[model samples]
Target: MKDKTLLFINGDAPKSLPSPANYELIACTDGAFHYLKRMGFPLDKLAFISGDFDSHSGSDEDMYEEKFILTLDQEKTDFHKALEIIQDKGFSEVDVFGGSGGEQDHFLGNLTVAFAFKDLMNIKFYDEFSEYYFISNHFTLKGAKNRMISLYPFPSVNNITTKGLNWPLTNESLSITSRIGTRNFAVEDEVSIEYESGDVLFFAGNKEIEYPTIY
Candidate 1:
């Protein structure tokens, strides 16, 4: 288990949570506090809630009383506000749930944050189906044999190399104007990816995939 933080937003919660040992803390966006409380979650375990509070439709003011951070920025979404707090608290690894399965616009907005914050933190968006994240320039995936891996270049990516995948890439380029890697499967227990520049979002077709520890 890793020392990461779990963040819950206004979207639906999964059937089960990740092991408690993997997370150091739990946080919620203002939009999720009431729903989580109504669903009978452990409020005492909640560290804080950060957001503008315009989307909170719950009447339980007590849930966000002291835990609320009044971020009035309208340019960013509620998830972005909460993510800023996570960074301020110095948490590098974060798994976010309830950020999808709500409004389609909100789900798309969450992707914007995921890509924007790729380099700032190790963040992943999780739903009932799968978990996805932005892969670093050079990273490795362990215990990933036969797992469906999809790599989407944000706009363009250069010099991509891969090993242990069904279709290997040797310094190939994936650009928005040209080719994009999707529905690619890992053919070995470990998959390695090396790239020079640009954002390449990776998706695992499962609940979640374990990434090798970065030193």
Candidate 2:
């Protein structure tokens, strides 16, 4: 069965938007709603807009009153709160846009949030350059020929093995402070990765292709 995916947009506006038809539900942070509105996105299709609404004017709030979900918690980011709402709505798969770009710290914070929820749902981030996510201990990627792939350890990951890459890893370790596997290209149509411990953030080149859902 096709996965019921949620398309969630974050604060940093994406350069391009994906078709809403591909998602079972669509949502965005209030900060992202502005960009979507300005870009002529069909706001009527959004399931809800969640955020602190600090940047929103009174008129903006009144206009989107019904769809606005005021998240007042100062401790969490809009992206984090939005994800919580998505999870509460029983969504297990999310395709995120506008998670990167803007402040670099926010990008890192977004990654941290993603890592925290990795075990709860299948979350994939799509930027202009790549689609990244926390991969399972053993993962396989298809239709990856000639595409750039990056394996980055969140702090550290150990005892990794890989195949179908130009430079493969065999029982190797990657660390944030030490060695990381980045800028590697796929040499075959399929790639396989296995690891024993810790978390690995996998990055695959952002190109349209016919591949099954493997998350």
Candidate 3:
């Protein structure tokens, strides 16, 4: 059995969280832990904090217990380091909060992990404006009503379809060239998807906001 896991990424992006203190979270890199503190979040709740620690400043190290830090090397990005730690712990669902807010390359790199690990784990990226999730099987998005939901597939995605949206898809095919799945709105309180063959990446947002370079 896989435990529910929440991974926090402190990228150079903007964010609006429901609460500063309440969440099941794990820190991906050093910067994410810094962002969590700035947001008034409790660092004690993190299961494991993994990263190279090269980004860790003197004050940053003081904020966390030395026992909680799992320092990884530079061969892998902090995001991937965090992923390895989470996978080792056998976590199924992961929500990346700070990964999207940082540097441009960092934000893009986090997205790549979303595509890279869609099959291995249930991964989602969250920011103030939008929440992006990848679905290989059927799943539900429950939250505020009238939220906008868009589904996009990677280059490998093929023969996908969806239901319960402004534009319903019935046995439709998708690919990188065809982004017909973009910009969709949720009709009710929840949105769902069922794949015919490949994997589906879903991005849901209330509205578009200025993307961040680092969170």
Candidate 4:
């Protein structure tokens, strides 16, 4: 949490305020800035707002003049733009909220953007109930046994293995569209995930994720 430097607020963040200690820089996409401010965020905490400005308030224009960068490039999503800026600033790790709990299309788009940046940065997405991230290699997720755990493959994966889960996979193949791992439960103090090829998105039902002993 404190180690994370950037916080990205997407268009559909939880209505409750995220703890300020979670990040040093606050960035928002689409009209999330308006949403955050309306939700009682102090203006000074914001670093910048980036989006196509298709849904922002007219009143916030002059207010965020210097802080707002109008990115009219329709090719990239706001999440991508924010990551690019974060990378340009020399920081690759970011915790993003509001990736889900929104329109179905937007939520899925956010997931795609996260995978797109998997090689570029350390990215995590936070929603009201859980935080999610994708891994191309071996990964560990620590949580209490019986808590919810989900693993979804990006199209396809090979030679996947797991430990500390109620139902474990040993060198199994899982695909996103066809065979997905959902509604799984942790069975030990920590859950382990490893795969030989492709990306898998791991979901922890809560905010705090314990590191793998080997991490």
Candidate 5:
């Protein structure tokens, strides 16, 4: 049986929330739970709420005590600790929301955390503007015609090649401080990307496209 995806909400609070019915389980950090409650999200749908509970009051704790997961590790971010809980629960595919807004450093920190767990699970991040994730060395994206697509090297990528983009790369090298591929669009329905080494972050424009099933 195919594992149903886990929907995780972070602290930043997305402009919109995805339908909970699409996922097998729904979870959020304490920070995100506040926004979700204000937005009238059904708390019963959450499997567990994980965080240090620094912002939660006594009554708040009393109400959802069974669902609260106290993660007091000061070394890791709540986002990171939450993923560890998900991993322990045996869910490998996760769709994250509210990870990109608020503070820029937090956004970058979320990306860093996602990168750390990329090998353990399929983690995709969604925001109002786009859905992005770390891609394997070779990836094929479909239904991307006329949409903005960005292939960014986390730090550096080598011997990169691509097809079906308006401006394709062939055996090219991209580095963060040197050269990175961004603001590129797909001209065809399908796009293929291959690279010899290093990690690549793929960003697909969220407008007009159904949530991609290819992931």
Candidate 6:
């Protein structure tokens, strides 16, 4: 990790990127390095590459070995290994791309990691249409005033309350199998969210999501 790091966790990322990208840290997990190559990005731009190498072919391994490689055990996923490197460097915030566009299990695992480390740093999982984040504390959402914000429990939501939303909840206990906060709207400049006791994930999105497809 560098002063700033952009870690890719072996998922599907867009082919086009902003010119003179702002990532001070470019990281990849196992085959994510190869994915970067497929996107026409240079490996030299990566500060670190880590993973269990479970999906890496021989040629892919050699290609990534030209740079930094941190081979991990099967016990931990590639995303977890990348998090270790990120957290060890004391980063305050991480914008994770390519996480939500991969295998279903890995995508869910990335969400778990974001929730587990919510207190450590601010993380945002980027997909094609939206961004997902687990909120452990108070935060303000600012963007298009008409943006759609949905809140869902991570199988253990205790009590949640909200303000400046279309359908506000007040100190309500949410169940694991409930979609109580789905499809809420932002009514103010910034919607305030507060929750206690359980994990809560908020998805702010506008575009329609194509299920099971990373393209």
Mark the 10 consecutive residues where model 3 has the least summed lDDT.
206-215
Better of 1 and 5 by lDDT: 5
Model 2, position 70: C-alpha lDDT score: 91
Off by over 4 Å in 5: 208-215
TM-score of each: 0.85, 0.92, 0.79, 0.88, 0.92, 0.82
lDDT of 5 by residue, 22-100 (tens): 8887888988888888888888998899988888877754778899999999999998999898888888889998888
Candidate 1 lDDT by residue in tens digits, 17-45:
65555679789887787677677777777
Could you tell which candidate, 2 or 3, scores higher by lDDT?
2
lDDT of 4 by residue, 1-215 (tens): 23454565564757576677667677777567766776777766777788887776677556766888788888988877888887777777788877786578888888898888889888988777777898757687655565678888887888899998777899999997678897677768788888899778888786434434331
Residue-pair clashes per prediction, in order, are 0, 0, 24, 0, 0, 3
Instruction: Put down candidate 6 lDDT per residue, 60-165, tens digits, no spaces.
Output: 5575576566555667677777787888777656777788765788788888877777877778777666678887657677763556788878875766888877
Could you give candidate 2's per-residue lDDT for residues 1-215 as a string of tens digits? 33555555554677788888888889888888878888888888988998888888777558677998999998988888988998888888999988888888889999999999999989999888899999999999999987889999998999999999878999999999999999888878999999999999999997644443332
Clash count for candidate 4 is 0
Lowest lDDT block of 10, candidate 2: 206-215
lDDT of 3 at 193: 73
- Checking candidate 5 for backbone clashes, the offending pairs are none
Quote the lDDT for 190 in model 1. 93
In angstroms, give how far residue 157 of model 5 lies from its true place: 0.7
In terms of lDDT, the poorest run of 10 residues in model 4 is: 206-215
RMSD of each: 5.4, 4.8, 6.0, 4.8, 4.5, 5.5
Distance from true position, residue 80, model 2, in Å?
Answer: 1.0
lDDT for predicted candidate 2 compared with the true structure: 0.86
